[model samples]
Target: MSDQPANLREQALEEAALWFASLQDEQVSEQERQAWQKWLAESVWHREAWAKVEQIDREFHQLPTQRSFQALQSAGRSRRQFLYGLAGAAVALPFAWHQRDILQAAWTPGTLHQTAVGERRQLALADGSQLWLNTNTLITVDERAARRQLFLLHGELYLQSAPETQALRINTDYGSVDMMNTELNIRLGNNSAHLAVTTGEARVQLAQDTTPVTVAKKESLAFNQTRSVLTEGISANDEAWRKGYLVAENMRLEDFLKALGRYHSQGWLKCSDAVANLRLIGHYPIADTRKVLDTLAQSLPVKVRHITPWFTLIEDNRNISHS
Candidate 1:
């Protein structure tokens, strides 16, 4: 009775692992499919654990060799096998042999890296690529000679991918995108992924579908989890967030706040409905969201209120008499 929570957590993680494995199996049933989807959207902890499993799945799919891929596929835990590893070793030996030793050698524990109430971090990858982890970001990378991949599990990342021997790809929960000599960035919301290409050309292919659409430089695309339709837009400052600032020229207040919230750990930035239509044209820093918020409040006809450590509300302040 005392260990039920721990058991449930472990069970939840195992269920996530099974979900990914089932994706690679052709005979997966509709019930199993719906079950996995339900678990994913069940709770924050469930989603986090599922993300860790997907992180590993992306790594497995991006490996340079088939042996590594097979190993990962075999190491996948089953509800029965996880609980009876010792007893099932004999029964699972043949499958394990086919899986290879990649899983054992490259087992990476899951970790959640997040920004504090107001913090940001610049990350440098081993391949010389750079990542600007947005506030409250939880990302994981699986780099290999044959493939370069990133899982923008939540939040956002300003990615400046370095040249690679092979193609580079960024896999999200919804789909996978491929890049070529380009600077691409991704922002993950509830069930959507917004992608912007700052420089060079690239292509994005939805996972459920095969054909990919080419995106020229300075193009942006948005993808919803359940829909294959991609919404397209244009932004000159596609990579501006990487420069520690977001440049907006006559952007709407609501849109600007949405972008600003990406760099905030508190993840709450709301513009009053009264001032939502206000036009904003300025540069907001990504490194320090507080500075940006302060600058906006002082420069605009609004009052910034800290509702909580991580939540902020911007409202109209029209009480200044003609004194």
Candidate 2:
């Protein structure tokens, strides 16, 4: 009986190994893709075993290309070398590695993600990373094992990366940054790109044309993705969304409304162009943005009107209050 179980285990591992090899070829026939999909869905054990192999393969790929080659080339090195490293130690570590490889090979380069209006999604990567995306956010994941990569096309997100054998990176319209055990928030504003780190640390290598800056815990920074203005440790104001709130410390009314609008459905919040330059300060509940609008109406000269359950417009062509 034990011998039968042992044979099954060996069979499973062999199947997994083959899948890993198949993933390397850039071109796979549709028939082969369908066949693999069938095998993955046929039995839970088959899927689970293949999943393990994939995780291992991803970690293998993530290794700095040189380091990975060295480890693979070294007779002394074992699979364990790639199993124990990551931002989060997945006891199912091999599973994480294998999944990474699987997803990378399957992804077509330059795939873009977009949210139409009141859409938000939480993405979980094969390597165990979690992305809390805000409405109207656009992003793409580039799954290279040696370095985990994400490209933010627009809007905001909260990222918690899984442990890996190598560094993890996030790319923006401006430049790219590597993250480790950290929480990062990104917002693309007019003429400026903003970043805030709530926990841990990040190394931001500015665009080659601009100056580089590193952001640490509880710090905020901004730069012109198109220009060379680099500022650091400005304030920790961007962490509000993580708690379902928007804490604006002396922010322009237009900017505040834009940030607040992400929490609600599309067309729900809008500010008149006249108040675009008006600066306001306070903590607004993102979870209940309507209440915040009410507060704004009472405190400021503006009036908030609900166009629908899904939309609201704020207008104050003339100033009724001064700050």
Top candidate on TM-score is 1
User: Lowest summed lDDT over 10 consecutive residues: which window, candidate 2?
Assistant: 73-82
For each candidate in the order shown, give its overall lDDT on alpha carbons: 0.60, 0.59
RMSD of 1: 17.6
TM-score of every candidate relative to the true structure: 0.56, 0.52
Show model 2 residue runs off by greater than 4 Å: 1-119, 163-165, 210-212, 225-237, 250-255, 263-281, 298-302, 306-323
**Model 1, span 243-315: residue lDDT tens:** 6678989988878887666556442466656677888887777777788889888888887766433236676
Tell me the lDDT of candidate 1.
0.60
Q: Which residues of candidate 1, in runs, are more than 4 Å off?
A: 1-118, 225-233, 307-311, 319-323
Q: What is the lDDT of residue 292 in candidate 1?
A: 86
Q: What TM-score does candidate 2 reach?
A: 0.52
